[model samples]
Target chain A: MAQLRSLLLPTIFCLGGLMGNYFDRYTQSKNIVAEKASLVTTTDNKCSLGDIPSSAKEIMKFGFPSCENLKFREDYVLSYNRVHRTANWVIEHLTADKVFQRDFKRKSSMFKEDTSVPVLFRSTKKDYRNSGFDRGHLAPAGDHGYSLKALKDTFYLSNMSPQVGVGFNRDIWKRLEEYTRNQTRVYTDIYVITGPLYLPKESAEKDGKRYVKYQVIGKNDVSVPTHFFKIIVGDNRKKKSNAQLQLQVFQMPNEKISKGTPLDEYKTSLKSVEKASGLLFLDKASSLAIATDRSAI
Target chain B: MAQLRSLLLPTIFCLGGLMGNYFDRYTQSKNIVAEKASLVTTTDNKCSLGDIPSSAKEIMKFGFPSCENLKFREDYVLSYNRVHRTANWVIEHLTADKVFQRDFKRKSSMFKEDTSVPVLFRSTKKDYRNSGFDRGHLAPAGDHGYSLKALKDTFYLSNMSPQVGVGFNRDIWKRLEEYTRNQTRVYTDIYVITGPLYLPKESAEKDGKRYVKYQVIGKNDVSVPTHFFKIIVGDNRKKKSNAQLQLQVFQMPNEKISKGTPLDEYKTSLKSVEKASGLLFLDKASSLAIATDRSAI
Candidate 1:
């Protein structure tokens, strides 16, 4: 965290709770021009969520975890958190064709304010401008390689969460995303739900009781999650019933992670991730099948 | 030009002509994955060039100046020149609404090979990798604010010409682009033609006859233009006749230009740019009207 202090100035000494009112007003009207311009043209030939397979949609309902201020786009959807000024979860379905695409080059730029969000509650690029944390994408752009617009939509600030840039974002987290896409080779299509987790840990205590503790960055007090999670449900179209569905859940810390670490080492049950984030995922019917057919990591 | 030598090796000294066969074979297969991925998704409901107003279309016919292997996208069109490994010109029609967009951030990356062009003749980012010159966009991404996809399309290597980075690309040329966009405040829609100029001067002579002398960068032999040109045609749709049509043509040297220099100082005639590039623009019918009703610079 000393590196964090070096990169940021603790100019506003008040607690995160104290800046809510000011943050509300600032995000409401800031950067309107840039955000609005992109919205108008992006809607062309957008694919509707109705196109989402019903079985995949069923899992998405619970996996979203927190539905506060949910936002929808043709390629993906999310439940946004005005308090965190970031997404609670971003959900998308990646088909085999999307995973196979390699045409468009990545557009690497700073994250932008997601104008599609209600102005008062939207996050601004300024929130992370000089803040030490990288604006990491919960719904990775590399997965949407099939469509340029889908890839561009991923850049919207609402899809981003603050995460360590060096070892975490550029290293382990990136490898995890690549691994997820690589799984597309084995499944016909995959439904993904990715979000941050702020769970109670022994390292931080408030009022002599251990509680979940994380740093809040920028004027908006965007909560930096202690860890992040990805819940994946893969569809094996060849099977007749839900029996063929494959579920893989992973949770990783928001800290330096070694490059060669096996992904199986970080595997966790959906039930565990749900408890930490306090969000339900998968209905009992689907959960029962997963429990019976679960494969050993 | 001397500054360029400092940033690039003066290797393969025979001439720009010597490596044509090698460049032809290499660009054909290099970076196949990145370029091919984008072409698949970009074809969604593309806006046709026929949508351009008759008057604007007439002007574009010549401003594209050459119809050889013309490439068309939703927002703009250009004629690809295999020898130069860049567009002879990129022509676009911009409305007031477009000039005002500010939402999306610029994607900063090195030039990529344009897959839309014939692979054997296209330019690659590697050509400019250590060549010291910037892969400057003939069609500035800033002007395509109306659509993020349009802005992204501007990144294709076919639309780029090698430019001096610091003083030219960053300073004067950037300001000129801003000036052009600012004109949107007065005109309803504007037609723009921008490209490189490989004009011969008295100083560069062979056999006492002036010959075009320009540097070739990288192993690909991508030609570096000595100057650049921009021809803008603005239409005041409110006016019923040709009285509303306004044209401004400018030519700037590919060297350091002071920020404070007045734009009028660079103003030239379309005929001059046409003669130097050996391309005809604004066919006889439209040329007659521009000559008779040309506005003062």
Candidate 2:
């Protein structure tokens, strides 16, 4: 029971109690504040991708998160989730030269269906019509701006998420994209993973148990994530020996975010984002989980 | 004339051609891209304020700027400039506990005259009356909110700079203040110096030479600053040994700033802001100036 509580509650707090829908174990924990403390960070002052290996290892680099719908593009790799009709996460490797050399402007592109995904399971532009949500890019077109083909490939419905147009997509999220580009100016290289999060705010009590709640949208029943997460794995440019990676994670609400809300306010521990998303990077997944469980107990 | 051009051209490029008031020295020197390489940053991984002595020196620790008009308030120190009727810089040393432990709210206090300044040069609220500028804060009132007396002291006319009210003061500046507060969460301590800049843009070619130009406001002829700068000296919380301080400097136009503009866009090197403002900070003033001269030559 102690081991179960340790594993169950850290994941609950990591999901911020939003994962109660999947497990009743989250309902058993009453120490919400204490449990949330399980989130953590680890840093090594080295300048490489650390343990995730390289692009050549492809999808296996971060161990696929139980979802096999993977697409590897020229610049990024992503895993599509058939149930949600959105990419589980889009991963991209960015370098200073690659970002600075690009001078492309945003061009209009049709959100075409991914021929890669089965037609019956793929999301299309039709589902988003009049949904009052913007077809937000998980892997923003700006990151792929160096290549016309890469830029257009970002328009595929597979990379799109249902983002609120006004504040979240147009304002704060747009700023985050620019911030990522600017980081390239300082760091030699960085790996980025962008995805949607459907965590719940309130829990419904039913049959002496709690369940997480969220909303869905469109004919495809695409999930309207309660928040969005971006995880950055960075290599400090000055430190080239042993290739130690520094990590920073940000999770923002799916609501209106005011301008200049310091990025620090949204920064959460990378361990938590990994637990919530079930996606692992950097070779720390098993060790982080062990540490989380031990800390919880 | 060559010496003047050397000194003058460096300042012009440092201003990034924002000084159109100067001769087409900016346009003539088409190397705006190359000249900007003068911006340099030096870092020591030590965690404490270097060469500033220690906390026993308190506000005097950072070494005072040359202004004789100094205000040693309960929580902060400022070097006032009688000509502009604003502090050349408002200096504050902030810690996480002092900032976060307080629950104080912003209270409206009548802007009053500072009796400390000589009557001949002191500015008054009447000067700003019907003037199309907000009594912008150099050291934001928010930083002093912990003490009612300290908060009221911020209302003194001497601490105010003439700033555009809406977007510049109420939005971007406010965001910057909050961003500073947020930094305390990570750094053990940080020293902030906020001030205004009066640099010339678009040189006026006269008698085969150039001169800097600017505007003034109200009866007191308070010089309207073309830009504002904030320099932050931070101690990495984890590295406390030899006291290596990390530095980041920002300069912003005294104009309407759009919401969600990435902070990185406004980031300039410490060397340039020092050259533009002619104010020395830390103990690197002389060395930075020498470095600047070398880079220019």
Candidate 3:
């Protein structure tokens, strides 16, 4: 444990320093409390005007990816990327009770346009009809099975991305989602932020240049992300207020992955995800020490 | 003129209908007056805590493209795309006095990183170095020549994008900037919004897929937009309270164009630009009849 701590201390400090700068900028750009309160009052049915929803506050306890077009859902909060016709990021807070309840059926929910988004920017069912890609959920539907409304809210097209089917979305990506839900057994609370990435690769021309290339499907020209990322933070604060949290970040290619591949193969550093996605995660919570152990949960 | 109006009325009405929905969403998502007032007071050097800069109010009089990471400068307003390490869009309100008054020398200014942006998301000079692309200005420096500070503000890397050096940025793009500035001679006020686009092209693999492909330069991986667009709105309301405005939109590829090609050849419909860019232009001002004449200026 001492050896591991020695190794991880530098990374933790580095991230802590970087996040300090980011946290300042985030606060200056958007007043999170006021914005969240306003969003909850306006969009959420359970909350009246001037009343803040506890679900939104708990789900976004860490930090927001970007403060563009935000949607506060019943069980999750999302920032929509209008240009991509999909979510920039969707965040959810999961507990053992929420994941294990299974009070709702996924089959009962149907994918529909999020009318909260203007028609011009909203993704539709037709965009993915013959596009050969699945309407993959950013915030997996299984995680919000505690209530029917929560499960149905996950079906909004705004929360969907054009993800590869067969081996990727159905196989390995589903495994990741299952693994995330299972983590609720170990930690008191699990905070997860999932989003798409259009990463660059070295050009095939051998010209020493890198290019970001992605496909667009249908008339709306929805962007097919090159990869998807999930950053999971497991909080053990209920056990002891000062207990270190476990941080695990994964980046998987939006393509087929062989079965039996270890989930740890996709584990990545938080800095790389932040740099590529142009978002800062856990900035507000960086004051607390975070353990970087792969075997933690 | 009557024949042109008859042909253009449908497009205008369609855009008006579409924008009606968008304007409502825009207003709900962002209280333009409050946000602008807050942004001006926070960022502008000349303005005190409660004073809203008239410059920002005027430049963004029509509508904002996306209000993510907006930087309100002395002469222009920009929405920064942290993921791309470049400006998403920059809006500039030009007048005959501002464009014609050459108070600053181009050589006096130097391109530098925008310190206001968190260093993790900033685009540095090194990103453009040896990348075989020009540090092209979104809001042309020539238009801000009325003041040294305004000219210097244009040098911020936030306002720069990677563009083809010789044929595009130097020769053709320069001509476009010149043409935009020259328009101030004809119109009392010219509002121009310029930005990059990562438009998709039909896949070469014959898979019937469309792919958005762009190169990334240097360590920061600043995106090289596949195309660039400029939407110019000429307002003659000063002459009469309800005088019709002339609106022209152009999209040019980020590569070499034949030197003798006329600028009008790149003229495109506003709907096409809005669709490809995933942004609404002049949405708030849609109630005003806009002339679609290429020769209006």
Give the candidate number with the greatest DockQ: 3
iRMSD, model 1, in Å: 32.1
Task: Order candidates by TM-score, high to low.
Answer: 3, 1, 2
Each prediction's number of clashing residue pairs:
8, 18, 0
Best by TM-score: 3
| RMSD to the hidden true structure, all candidates | 27.1, 26.1, 13.9
Cα lDDT for residue B232, candidate 3:
90
Clashing pairs in 3: none
Candidates sorted by lDDT, best first: 3, 1, 2
Deviation in angstroms for B272 in model 2?
1.3
Q: Which parts of model 3 are misplaced by more than 4 Å?
A: A1-52, A291-297, B1-52, B291-297
**Per-residue lDDT tens digits of candidate 2, residues A176-246?**
88889788876777778899875422223333222223344555455566689997766553556444455
Q: lDDT tens string, model 3, B114-176?
A: 876666678999999999999999999899989999999999999999999888999888999
TM-score result, candidate 2: 0.39
The candidates' interface RMSDs, in order, read: 32.1, 29.1, 20.2
User: Mind giving the per-residue lDDT tens digits that candidate 2 earns over B1-297?
Assistant: 853432342233224222212221101222222221111111100011112223324654444433233465667777666545677788888878767755566555668887665443457787777767898988777777777877787788888888888888888878888888888877887788889875544234333222233345554556567789988766653556544566667899988998888777888876566545544455432333224332442
Q: What DockQ, between 0 and 1, does each candidate earn?
A: 0.01, 0.01, 0.16
Q: Whose lDDT is greatest here?
A: 3
True contacts kept of each: 0.00, 0.00, 0.32
